[model samples]
Target: MDQLPTVQPHSPIMAVLTEIEYESGMEPSFGSIHDFCLELQELFTSSGWFFYVFSLKGVTKDGITGLYRDGSRWTKSKMPFPDIVYNRIHSRRSESSQIFIDFVEKMNEASIPVFNRRFLNKWEVHQWLNSRKNLQRFLPESCVYSRNSLQRMAASHEVLFLKPVNGSRGRDIMRIQSQDSTCDVSLSSRNGIESLNTCQKEDLPAILKRYLKKQLYLLQQGLPLLKMDNRSVDFRILCNRSSKYDWRVTSTVARLSAQGHFAANLAAGGDTIHPLRVLRHFFGEAQSTSKLDMIRELALEAANCTADSSEELFGELGIDVGVDDNGHPWIIEVNSKPSKNDHIGKSSCRPSAKAILEYAQILLSETNPPEKGGSR
Candidate 1:
């Protein structure tokens, strides 16, 4: 007999949709999905936005058939057109489908705004940022990985990274080091980090051919990243659009790689330390402030650059930046469909989540402004 809480001052309804394969109660809902919806609902309701969670399958042309709080339990209910949609379609396979594309297009035609539009391709983002002269210094030399490109980069930089153009969570990344007679290759796999050593540099093409036969890869010069406890570390800057549509750095977290691993992605057995903690640990308290400011500025620039390039509206980005031993910052990667994990920020506020709803409200107000009575 536990009643579902109701939203307050619910004038504008917001829908959060994700891919759900089966009906609820037929099977257990994904815990993460449920938690995400629950958390978002609480935040949205507190801010006077009516929020509900629905699956893609539940949407229709007339309106959306979604689950809403009905006394003690969630029950099927129909909702009018939503003012905005917060997409949480987590499956790559689902997003790739023609059906999903058509659905989004249809929603667009119906005038519903979707935030954090889609996943960004690494190469496309790099190419966009690389063309800007101001951003060029922060970008490492990167090009489509080909037999010749790999060899050329190997001849230039002592170490290079081969990354999938569409990869996430540091999956399938490889670290390649060109030695006098051999190329040292280390791959990040689900099982663990694996390395291929003592392979003649001349035979790299043949050896890599099988692995990259149909995959797209980017070869980037490896920066001498700052290390923590002898493990390579990088920063993940969570940026979100303000109510005014300006990009703001919500928070920055430092990810330290597992020993012997090059990737600092959380999925790759890495650990996260707050950037302030990292700064204090590396540079004394007296010097951490300036360095922190430098990182914030760099991250803001990257976020704005990405926003300028993307034609679709994106409200959030996770930008990975690395600081070399010399203290120069480099843009490593930019993720549009960023995972919202551990977003606790200054003053105990979940900045990323709060920013999302605030921006969504701004968008909705612009799109569907309330009528002013007895006004000029």
Candidate 2:
């Protein structure tokens, strides 16, 4: 496996932002996540504290020295040690899986605050975030799968979206619709749309079989979201918990999908607009502003609700909010690390990165207080 180059050790103040290096065995490149870590590092550095990023992958000085290896023994490095280990490892399989897990365990044992705390597992987080009672106002009818449940969902709704339970970036998403006794299916992709029409009663069994062979997925009733210029639109609400444990809205933007596309994801070629403008156009001057206010309230409520339920020390969240024809807001999804695409400091918005860094400082203060001679 290839390795990441390392930076030279600076003073202790500069070393406060070390990262827990993830081995290259992980599937997705850590570029985006790494950028986030760097953002946090910069934020901490400006706050009079040092930040250092440490990865288990051997630490190399400008791609020369390899301090660690796959089968080699671990050793203390000359680099400044970390006061906290942010567990961003996403590896599902590895030869050193046990070793990495142990490292995280040691960090926890040492009282270094971990972002997720490992208490709220992924499934638990999803269930809590998507619960009907908790987020009913902002969610569509969604149920974890079984063949019978999917068939029932198909029978009731004209169209439904089937998604992977652990999916992201709109991958492996399919739309199913009923047409008399026949059912139509469309697979979503960046390349183009591929679809098939089949009998609902007779074809469901085979379709379910094919879907089950892949992985676990969820069946969701399709929401009738308002559209702009024949394209569906959704809002990305960025929320973060300050050091004071108060949830604050960092930013919100309207993502409008291109014509003929169902997803409004940026990766899917969607364009972004101001939410205030989109809502005003969709609802008209008199009623649109009121609706926007309501959407903001609901977004903040959902963020607080999720933060209250989870035990993790999360400082930020990216929530996808959809507005129905009734001018009501519904949550589409909650992202742990919301992208900085339309971040504040950009065009008309506040810098979300700055807010996130400030929040992290607060969290760190709460978790790791300064010594008697030091400042928090």
Candidate 3:
């Protein structure tokens, strides 16, 4: 790997980028990203470290077209090679673009440390967890969706969740619940739940064939998740590696799904509640605190497990956990590029953003350590 130019340990630069459209002239902004930058700036002094936001097109052989604040206003300026590049590119199409791909390729070639490096698919994580005997208990029985796999799972589990292998935000997930004589399929959407009722059991294959034809899906046994007011609720724990490079739980919130939906993703019309409040509501005060602790521990374990398998540097993870009716916690999903939907205006989540910056500093030092002749 090529090496990024070494810099003074105390005064390294950090560059953050997301998709930018220069033609629109619209200010590049996202609520959570803005708050994150503000907090990162306040925590890391400008005299010590400089932070800049840029676009995909901004990157070139010379440097990045970075945006920095000049007094009370923002200004675009050419920047030097940063000690690290924090990629926040969100658009799939943008990431697939030749320019964006080249930028990442060059960044890697230059050995500029980038953490939270790439997206991990659902099937990949499930496979990793299943391979570990210690962690298998927390995972739902899952397998790549096939006609045989689907039929076998449907026989054992009354309810099965069919999820797109590479999907996020609870999109393109289907719930196949077997009723007495019919199978009810609920497809999750941004607008609302779309339900399909099949009258005959034999018709399930034909019905599912239509939906499962092109896309790859994972068949997971649905847990009897602990519910609040007839709505399923699960916890989303934000875990990050601190400056010390140890995993820590930063923020956790309980997501309550809409009345009939099984998915509790915030993007799927779910509401967020303080984890404790939701825990206490279901498990009561005595057990609620303990349950929260269990969730945190499992989250840390999941983070470490993934880090162990992946070669890429990861500084943060979003772990979704579901507590069964029996009070056992099940790992639902692990996200590499967790959404910032809940971070907006939530002071509690600021630590996660801070941890990312601190971890970046650690990576910078590891990649380009200062000489002993220089100041410690």
Candidate 4:
């Protein structure tokens, strides 16, 4: 596995690995990504790091073959193997492929850092968190999707959520409410929950089978989430590893569910506001500050637990926590590749971009130190 030593680049390169966009007729596109590459390039220009976009095809090649912006157009060329790989691949299916696995293994053997190497599904994450007792309080009862499991959960909890293991943007999420003799099923679309159907306990399985077919789902105990204006509220806490490789809360915001909706995802037309603002509206100003601190602590704990649960390196994580009527935080979900940067910079360097570059530099130095007169 050893090759002749070659001089490392003076300016470290970071390839933002992304999937290709097929519908981008003439213009080059990466995984529905538009201006991300240009913005990152512009942001890192004044720094010692270099950022370029790499396609999934590059992963199977000999060296890192990537594309970069020349002017207004994109140019394809072979790039110096990245000092660090920041995976931005948006497709869960692509990430699960054998090629992606092999690529990550190769990088690991070479001591090349690839942060957020594998996308973690809901079931896998649940199992990981279940390994630690201290973190169990923040987790809801979750199990792999099955008709019997769904019915069993429904029997115990008055409310349950049937979620696709790999579903995103709140699509195909079903909420079930059990009554005396009828079970109600509510389906969430791209926007939010738009329709509901009620059925008997025996009829519920037939309906779900017709809707879900053979697709996998996870059954979760639902929470009576805090609501404002008849719409539920949840918190998205973005945690990033600092230059020192320590977990820190990058930002936290409260998402208000769309009108007549149950899902609070931004892609589902939900609105985001400062968490402190929402807390103040409920709790006193002084209490709001303390409550925010508590949420941050909980988020940090979840972040650490996630990193410790997996063998893969994680540079950042997006932890979604649902606050019940009692203001208790429960782990709703964790996103490995969270892209919502509501707190992005307007004039200065973008915080998320800066954090990524700083973490990359740390990995490069940690993996292989530089010589006396040069950097690794």
Q: In terms of TM-score, which candidate is stronger, 1 or 4?
A: 1
Residues 1-376 of candidate 3: C-alpha lDDT, one tens digit per residue: 1233333455777777765444346665634467576566555544467666788777777766766654553457776566677777776667678887787777777677777767787888988888889889999999999879987998899999999887878887888889776898878777667885564667887888877648788999989998888878999999998754479998888888877676887777788888899888778999999999999999998998888788877888999999998889999999887777665343643777778777877887787733321122
Better of 1 and 2 by TM-score: 1
lDDT of 4 by residue, 1-376 (tens): 1222232357666678887553446866764345556667776545655556777786655665666655666666766566678788887888888888888877777667889876777888888877889888888888987877977888889998888888876788888888888888988886557556789988988877767746678899989888988988988888988855478887788988888777788776788888988888887697888888888888888888888878789998988888887778788888888754455335444566667767776787787733321232
The window of 10 residues in a row where model 4 has the poorest summed lDDT is 1-10
Q: Kindly give the number of clashing pairs for every candidate.
A: 0, 21, 0, 0
In model 2, how large is the Cα lDDT of residue 152? 81
TM-score for all models, in order of appearance: 0.88, 0.77, 0.89, 0.87
Give the clashing residue pairs of candidate 4, or none.
none
Q: What is the lDDT of candidate 3?
A: 0.77
**What C-alpha lDDT, on a 0 to 100 scale, does residue 255 get in candidate 3?**
89
lDDT of 2 by residue, 139-204 (tens): 777787777887788778988887776666666678887778877787777854567446556677
Model 1 compared with the native: what TM-score?
0.88
Least lDDT summed over 10 consecutive residues: which range in candidate 3? 1-10
Q: How many pairs of residues collide in model 3?
A: 0
RMSD of 2: 6.9
Candidate topping lDDT: 3
Across residues 194-294, which tens digit of lDDT does each residue of candidate 1 receive?
88554898988887775663778989998898998888889888898885558888888888887767778776677888887877777779878788888
Off by over 4 Å in 2: 1-30, 33-41, 54-78, 85-100, 116-126, 129-134, 344-350, 368-376
Judged by lDDT against the true structure, how good is candidate 1?
0.76
Which residue pairs clash in candidate 3? none
Indicate whether candidate 1 or candidate 3 has the larger TM-score.
Answer: 3
| Candidate 1 local lDDT, residue 229 | 85
The C-alpha lDDT values of all candidates are: 0.76, 0.62, 0.77, 0.76
